[model samples]
Target: MITFESVTKRYPGGTVAVDALDLEVPDGRTMVLVGPSGCGKTTSLRMINRLIEPSEGRILLDGRDISQTEASELRRGIGYVIQQTGLFPHRTIVDNIATVPLLKGWPKAKARDRARELMDLVGLDPAMARRYPYQLSGGQQQRVGVARALAADPPVLLMDEPFSAVDPIVRATLQDELIRLQAELRKTVVLVTHDVEEAIKVGDQVAVFYPNGKIAQIDTPQRLLGDPADDYVENFLGFDRGIRRLAFFPADGLDLQAGIVLGDGTTVEQARRAAKQAGESWVLLTDAGRLPRGWAALSDLESRDGREMLAQMPLAPYGHTFRVGKDSLRAALDATVLSRTGLAVGVDDQGRVVGVTSYERLRAAIQAAEEAADGQGARPS
Candidate 1:
């Protein structure tokens, strides 16, 4: 556990970087410090490892005052990862990962062996072990940096916007990798990021810092979105917080309608008659293999056209399918909006459309679920 007791950092210019802040980070849980620039988020993380000293007060690592320990020794027991990676340009990937182990007086062969293990743990192929940092991609280099941090099996790990420099796609992948690693290793992680979304995605607890290094609020991601403490925190959470919160609510068990899905090779006469009989403006279509193929308008196929001509008419494309009993309410809502008919499609394990649901129905279902949960919470245990 990390405890910050009235810790403060005042620069040489007499400017306060971190005010007398008190915070507690639980053991084996990730705590993300997030805010705009000059928020002293990075400063707080540095203070943990004694990279930067506090001007007043104390920081305790598992009850030992960090200030009492030598900086180099303290750092050896803690792992640190930075944005640009800070990897040695000429060092091989294995050597880079084994840097800390070698520094701690381990045999070269044992260090190399541990480096290989970490490479696999971080999802990097063992074949890349011989390559230099310059030979790796941005994402790959970041993985090396992480491996280097874990080399000595440190219980505490610090990361500063480690995935920020990469593209969104790669960043997401890296985020998933970190989540996987944390599940397996459960290090006491303190990560710093300016991206609120990233903080919510990865943090067990999020600390929103103010300009003067004061924490505006600290809470779990769901609570932070559902209940913002102030205007500053609300504005930082963005305008679509309500919508974002729906990710936690599942779309399963909501009222869904089994749709009229006509398979391919069904004649225009058959489709027109089906649409008229069903009283639907559009008929759901399936490809030759019974998979969803957009929706065909009843009016477009109403002409005295033959099967070939009807096949040529454009079918409005639908959104991706939401799996019943699996996906979130947000996914269901998005699927409904993306479809031309404004109906969310639910699929089975085989990827076949099991049913369709309307937006109004989804909203009511969510409301009921919330009410039930609220009622349960109100009941005495």
Candidate 2:
């Protein structure tokens, strides 16, 4: 755990970089400090490692004052990542990863072996172990940086716009990798970024810092999008926050409708009966396990007179099916919009048809969820 009690930073000319900030980052949680330029985000992170000493207040690391710890020792125990890859151009990837371990008096062979292990841990191949930083692509270099940071296996990890240096595709891949690593390693991570979307995607808890070293609000991404503390926070969350909030809600609670499903190899007569029972013009065609195939109009089957309804051509294709219990509302909504029948096919984990949900029903669920969230003190009065 890390605690900031009235921690403030002052420059040589008395310029304040960080104000009297009081915050706590729980152990094994990814705490993101996000804001625009001059918000003192980097200063706050730097102070935790004693790179930029605070002029006032106290910062406690695991109940011990970081101020009391020696500066060089304090930095060795914290993993730091920055925007640049920061790998030494002259050193091999393995040597770069082994920098800290070597500095701490680990044998060269042991450090190299540890470096190889870290490379695999961060999804890097040993083939690149002997390559220089310049020989690797930007994304690959960033991976080496991550591997180097984890070389010491510090309990706390500080990242400052680490993925910002890569392209969107690579950045997204790195974000996913970080989440995967955190799930396994569970490091006490404190990351700083200017991107709100990145913060929501990567952070367990988000702190919105404003200009002049002030924290606007601190909350989970769901709560931040569902309810903003004030106008500044609401604007920062953006207008599509309602839509973004849907990603956090599961589709399992939706009251899905059944009976519109038709079995594979069913006769025209059978489909007609099922369609009539469903009170719909068309019945959804499903495979033997009740997984969706396409939509077959009852009239088309009726016109066929004596053929198998399953053999009849479909009116329109089924785009996709949303997992009934696993997928989120956004997935259901996307599926419903993409489907020709204006309904999302809800399926089980095995891809068997469970039921279906219409766009109206999906929208109503969103409204209901918003209302429930509002009533639970997530909305500003």
TM-scores of the models, in the order given: 0.85, 0.92
lDDT of model 1 at residue 364?
91
Q: What is candidate 1's local distance difference test score? A: 0.87
**Please, what are the lDDT tens digits per residue for candidate 1 over residues 2-57?**
99999999999899999998889999999999999999999999999988999999
Candidate 2 clashing pairs, residues 3+ apart or interchain: none
Clashes of each: 0, 0
TM-score of 1: 0.85
Query: Per-residue lDDT of 225-284 in model 2, one digit per residue for the tens?
Result: 877788888888788987888888889878887777767788778888877886677778
Candidate 2: deviation at residue 207, Å?
0.5
